[model samples]
Target: MSQLATRPPLILTLRMDSQSQEFFNAFRKTYFPPERNYLDAHLTLFHHLNDNDQTLATVKSIAQPAFTLKTTGMKFLGAGVAFAIESKELHNIRKELAIQLHEQLIPQDKQGYRPHITIQNKVSPEAAKQLLNELQSTFQPITITARGLDLWQYLGGPWKHHAYHALGPAPG
Candidate 1:
């Protein structure tokens, strides 16, 4: 069998700037259940994409420059919380990629995209609600930079690094 055919599915995530990554990752580590935290803080673009040449080519063809996305507020996930992101440029980039790799997208990826970085998950509802209320009390909007897209090979509980498709230089 071909390597691509036997390989695990790919997950695409927005690559945040170092500062932003650290900030979010800190929150993730402090709040997310250690037993269930298999990955760092991330904003997923696609939950699952086929691991194949076509999917790789489509990601490589994206020519957008690094851009800033605003963190509008917090999203209550019943059992967790995430910071909501807002960016027209990010949306457009995903739309273009979606068109190009429509055939490789799973049903979840085919749905509308609501960009977010999950900081905490897999906790009880009460714990989640208390954290949500605490965080929301002093929440202020912040802008974060998106530098690229990272592809990962899902390994059941953890992910293996696959590749990174860097975006062009940020516009001044």
Candidate 2:
């Protein structure tokens, strides 16, 4: 198999809503300049699909009509910013889906499993501390409903807004 065929695919996700999109865009703008805003707005559900056909088939097999996921609070990962999922159902569902993928399709990595959405990167230790302080003072809990799933490709290039492709509804 070719190298690209050997590598796994990525599942990009988000709480498909105007507020979520706007928030992501604003957050990116604040942290990353236009030139650096290569990564499109998304919350990743899982990564490293072993086989695209098998992965897609599995997803399709478990497909649901539709479902909503909500984000409830703000979290700080050093200098990285993220919102937490409030709904137990949403959290459980995402975890279950990831576990299923890991067990059935992809092998686990050394990193183990931890779910998060990265809002920004590139912070000095001092800057991270400052940002954390600011987050404590200024961050407010926000909620958003997720509605879609995307199958994305990392084209061996700088992160760009066009790297994602909609893969239809998420399997609820």
Candidate 3:
């Protein structure tokens, strides 16, 4: 059995600017199905990682230099929808961690990363489509800098936030 099967699987997220975070979160609260919405708007780096010393060590070791993130507009998620993200630097960070994790990563984390912030999910297909169109019609390119990385423990329904790994060169 995989380590994820034994312990709480860890999730990695890119910390967004406070303003943007507030906006997206409010957008989610307004649109997302209230009964199913459990977490705030976030950009997930790794969906599932095994919790261990190495995982925490590598996370804390990273000095995430702030990087520009662009929104490529909306994407249809069949029964849901999300704002697509574009960031080569973010992908590189994920790649670097993937290399370090090797076989320790969960199968889901092993796949290619398609970074996005889901604002609505598990709603009727028509509802999702309507929102996607509405958002896309009004969509303006948003450029924001990611401040750091966040590690979380997935608790069946709600998540337990662990720590935020600030980016940039560590002070000597």
Best by lDDT: 1
Give lDDT tens digits, candidate 3, residues 52-151: 8888898888756777899999999888889899989898898888888777777778878889989989988998999999998999888867889999
Q: Candidate 3, after superposition: displacement of residue 156 in Å?
A: 0.5
Candidate 1: the clashing residue pairs are none
TM-score to true structure, per model: 0.96, 0.70, 0.91
The full ranking of all candidates by TM-score, starting with the best, is 1, 3, 2
Worst 10 residues of 1 by lDDT: 47-56
Give the whole-model CA lDDT for all candidates, comma-separated.
0.92, 0.55, 0.86
**TM-score, cand. 1 vs. native:** 0.96
Each model's RMSD to truth, in Å? Answer: 1.0, 4.3, 2.9
In angstroms, the error of model 2 at 54 is 1.3
lDDT value for model 2: 0.55
Residues 1-172, candidate 1, lDDT per residue (tens digit)?
Answer: 9877888999999998999999999999999999998899999999888888888888999989999999999999989999999999999999998999888788999998999999989889999999999999999988999999999999887999899999999988
**TM-score, predicted candidate 3 vs. hidden true structure:** 0.91
Minimum summed lDDT over a 10-residue window in model 3 is located at 163-172
Give candidate 2's TM-score: 0.70
